[model samples]
Target: MSDQIILTTSSHLEGYRVTEHLDIVSAECVFGMNVFKDMFAGIRDIFGGRNKSSQNALRDARTSCLEELRKEAREKGANAVIGVDLDYSEISGGGKSMLFLVATGTAVKVEKV
Candidate 1:
């Protein structure tokens, strides 16, 4: 991670001004749930309990997606990313359940006010 790179969900960062607009950047991650975990999750869902396995998988995917977004922003010479958004979806095909996570933001150069 680049120390200079700032990420925020807001459209603007406090105490900093956007000096240049680079481009829109995005990163995506996909992971699958194993059969055992899927079975456990299904049971948990039926019983109406929190699915720790599913939650952990989502957390890991989100982390990876954010890291990729940071790398992209740094490569584009962006000091900050604003207006960030995250999306999560389930992709099931061929009897396999997969999770997809995507992070997106506008890369920009910001100067401290």
Candidate 2:
């Protein structure tokens, strides 16, 4: 069911016509920056270089959020989700940091045009 669902950032999917608009669906996924990773990131900021760990963490969060969004759309009897949007933010204080990710889209029923 997961693989059968289509997701798009555009308002509509090409070659597919929206027959019924279900409802909006969203999912959230969060990741915390451990002290070890935070230390490495700080060092990278001083050295001015790429941060592979940070990038990977962000990518992983996105994947998880989208996957859950897909599941929600499926449960709503939607074959696809259009106008997909992904948002990310950071929360930090007291020597601890976390990354929050939210994936949202409009669930719809679609068929080949």
Candidate 1: list runs displaced more than 4 Å.
Answer: 35-48
Off by more than 4 A, model 2: 1-3, 35-48
All candidates: TM-score? 0.83, 0.84
Cα-lDDT of candidate 1: 0.84
Q: Model 1: what TM-score?
A: 0.83
Worst 10 residues of 2 by lDDT: 39-48
Residues 1-113, candidate 1: write the lDDT tens digits.
34768999999999999999999999988877574366575664544566666666677788889999999999999989999999988888898887778899999999889
lDDT of 2 at 83: 94
Clash pairs (backbone) in predicted model 2: none
> At residue 16, what lDDT does model 2 achieve?
86
